[model samples]
Target: DQQVKQNSPSLSVQEGRISILNCDYTNSMFDYFLWYKKYPAEGPTFLISISSIKDKNEDGRFTVFLNKSAKHLSLHIVPSQPGDSAVYFCAASEGRGSNYKLTFGKGTLLTVNP
Candidate 1:
């Protein structure tokens, strides 16, 4: 039933500022979006992706945005530092291959309070 939702489990920013992370999906057949970080030991990696026909996508400072009719998606980190904190997983898939399965969202603990 949880087609993916990271309803602000946690988020604190400071270091350099700017760190917005949010994701929601009711499964509109998705399209593609991924943003993983996870660090406290190392695992999740990725860290940027968006393809729902393209709403926005960057890499340098990390940026990903998609609003396929408001299914919602976001991940922006500008000056945020402190190793970029961790725990940020919001994945989805429904393209590029047909069925690899990737629907995750239950992570959003990005704390970078220098």
Candidate 2:
């Protein structure tokens, strides 16, 4: 069974608009959430991550929000640009330690129209 899920398979946004990607998890044990961005023919790179202890985390133009009670999380990109277009994967881990297994969602393709 997939523990993490990205309901929207794709999202299209105009350049300079805000792009929001949503994710949900069935596992309550998850304590950490991570978002990865992948470009065509390239490896997925870590974009931003949030710990369950906090409701939100921000880095540059990207921000991630966690709602533990709802078992949901979302990533927001401000002033979306063509360069920001990519497949975004939502990942989660049971704990912060090394032994925890990571679970990943299928990913949501984000297209920023310029």
Candidate 3:
């Protein structure tokens, strides 16, 4: 079973528009949620994160909202730029510990049209 799922494999948007990416998880034990952005061959870079204790977390142009009750989460980018075009991976982990193993979604590729 896929504990995490990104229903949309790709999204296209005009530059300076809002980009929204959605993710869902079935595991109730996942406590830490994170969004990572990846470009072509480079490794993923952490964009933002939210603890299960909190419902939302934001950093500059990036915002992540988590609905613990619904087992869902979403990432929003305001005024999305061409530079923001990349593959976004939603991941979950138990917590910060030895047993922490990140479970990643298939990924959502965002294309910002210039």
Candidate 4:
């Protein structure tokens, strides 16, 4: 079973609008959640992350909100631009870097129309 799930396979938004991507998880052991953005041919780049202890984390125009009790998380991009179009992924880990592996969601393709 996929511990991390992005129910929406894709999303489309107009430039300067807000783009929201949602994710869900089944594993309660997950203590950390991360969001990554991937271009066509490059690898996924880390965008932001939140610990189970915090409900929100933000970096510039990107903000990630975590609802621990609901096992849900979402990434929000303000003033979305065409360059922001990419595949967004949600990842979860058990908080142990030494031996833990991150579980990734299928991914949500975001299209920011110019």
- Cα-based TM-score, every candidate: 0.33, 0.97, 0.97, 0.98
Better of 1 and 3 by TM-score: 3
Worst ten-residue run, lDDT, model 1? Answer: 93-102
What's the lDDT for all of these models? 0.91, 0.96, 0.96, 0.96
Error of 3 at 85 (Å): 0.6
> Whose lDDT is higher: candidate 1's or candidate 3's?
3
Q: How far in Å is the alpha carbon of 97 misplaced in model 1?
A: 16
lDDT of 3 by residue, 54-114 (tens): 9999999999999999999999999899999999999999778887799999999999999
Better of 3 and 4 by TM-score: 4
Index of the highest-TM-score prediction? 4
lDDT against true structure, model 3 = 0.96
Mark the regions of model 2 whose C-alpha exceeds 4 Å error after superposition.
none
Name the TM-score of candidate 1. Answer: 0.33
Candidate 4, residue 95: lDDT: 76
Q: lDDT (0-100) at residue 27 of candidate 4?
A: 97
lDDT of 3 at 94: 76
lDDT by residue for model 2 (8-100), tens: 999999999999999999999899999999999999999999999999999999999999999999999998999998999999999866687
- List candidate 1 stretches off by more than 4 Å: 1-14, 17-31, 34-49, 52-56, 59-76, 81-87, 95-102
